[model samples]
Target: MAGSSQKDRKKVGVFVQHECPLNLLPREIWSSIAVMVASNSIEDLFNMQATCKEFLGAASSDAVYKHATMSYKPLAHFLLHLDGPERRFLDRCVEVGNVDAILRHGFVEYLRFGRRDKGMELLARASTEGNVEAGYLCAMLLMFDHEDEEEVKRGVQMMEVIRISRKLESCSKFFRGVFNDAIVLLLEMFASE
Candidate 1:
């Protein structure tokens, strides 16, 4: 078999070792694994991407993108250059009460697609569920994007509500710090009075 042609080896029933362990996985299984990482950690994403071309493609597969969402800048940036069938994957982010998903979806709608009111609505939906970041974003959007005095006033009211909500204060001190900044904006708003 020495110096045999590539076909000769196959005739002898030689098992060829090809690709890495992860890459050897069924595309569906690999995508399943990759999707699990897409939602929570960029490092996990990069790790999966480093495995092989198969894994790299799997990392960006719609199954993974569905869970990952465009909230991640890389995913959003990647999706931007894509066309047709892949664009549908962008909206697959699950809506099952993941506040971050809600806020991130809102971010994409406003920043990427320029759908201001649509984005604000998504953020407001998250905020209503007691997400601090979502509330903060909703207030900011209302304040900056809307020219109506009523909208700014509504934003200010939102800030004040977020700042003092005992439910938020009790659960997340990190968010409490963020929510408090609303008071500064509120104070600045009222100071002109």
Candidate 2:
């Protein structure tokens, strides 16, 4: 009976020693997989991280955060009130040049908090990174808010590019609503001036 138990134990140990094929994949491949998972659903990425140490490492990559489609709704709440982990996650996304993160933070900073320069800088960065909504907002700000003729001309050119690209037609309704509200606010600001 003791000899039979020893043989079973050895078989179990051998099975445990066999590595998963996934564990053999390169870190770059894992990172790419993590990015895809993150883009699909950040929640899934978080769940993946809990699966194993290897997945946790991959999910923590900056590339994952950069490509992740974070929920903008929670971000709005975070903006109004600081939440530690969420704030840190937002900061990581922003640091990695996540376009949506930049756009949201820029919009809030510029429109809500009156941090014009910083907001414009972030907006411009997001626009340069291929966010059509940020491009539109930046053009609007440059055209209406700046007194400099050169800045106005640049804004006009930017708007022209956006129109030529037809990106505005495909933009999300949420962004369009935000854009319209911003236009109204800008008009009010100028009217009061």
Candidate 3:
């Protein structure tokens, strides 16, 4: 958020001037702008990345993909159904430091594909690894996956960990409302115990 990554999205212009080569832009600026541009229009960002190797580094970055998926439902939804080969490609994306990708994989496996135990295991691992979305998902799954009070308490603790974090911005504004409702539901569940 600070230091090297400040307002990177701002640098990616809607249109780079015809007179100026993109290479002329500062390296960090160029990458940040490309990622920002990717945030809004992934196709345009991919086109820019396709222009050359340097742009590829920026456009294909974990931060870029994370921002894109978190910001756009279409991208997230598309990821939910990735077939084996596509998932292998996605595995590369996550290898670049995107824990969200792993979390999403777990989510799709658990929710959409009905691989419940596998999904729950991945979610728990990801949450322990400090992925906040994973923490949120793990909490929800724990609530439903068992009747054990200890599991419920662990889930509540996970929710509390994220509830007050300054990084709650990591969850999209749309998802935040859902998460808040979830917290309330968890509270009610805890009270019933």
Local distance difference test, per candidate? 0.65, 0.78, 0.65
1-193 per-residue lDDT for model 1 (tens digits): 5666765755456698786776556889878878777766656777778877888888866567545633444323331333443333334443344565676667668866899888888889878976776787788678888899999999989878877875445334543443464455456657978
Better of 1 and 3 by TM-score: 3
Candidate 3 lands at a TM-score of: 0.56
lDDT of 3: 0.65
Model 2, 1-193: lDDT tens digits are 9888887874444345678777889988999999888777656777889999999998899888888765434334434443565567667889998997788778768867889899999999999998888898899889999999999999999988988997756544546655565566667667988
Q: What's the true lDDT of residue 5 in model 1? A: 70
Provide TM-scores for the models. Answer: 0.46, 0.68, 0.56
Question: Candidate 1: worst 10 consecutive residues by lDDT?
Answer: 73-82
Leading candidate by TM-score: 2
Q: Across residues 1-193, which tens digit of lDDT does each residue of candidate 3 receive?
A: 5865775656665865574475677677766777678656545776887888878776766666554443343324532346663465346545664565667667777866789888887778767777777877787677767699998888777767777785445554535654565566657667989
* Candidate 2 global TM-score: 0.68
List runs of model 3 lying over 4 Å from the truth: 1-20, 52-54, 61-69, 74-89, 125-131, 147-150, 160-193
Q: State the lDDT at 58 in candidate 3.
A: 68
Error of 2 at 182 (Å): 12
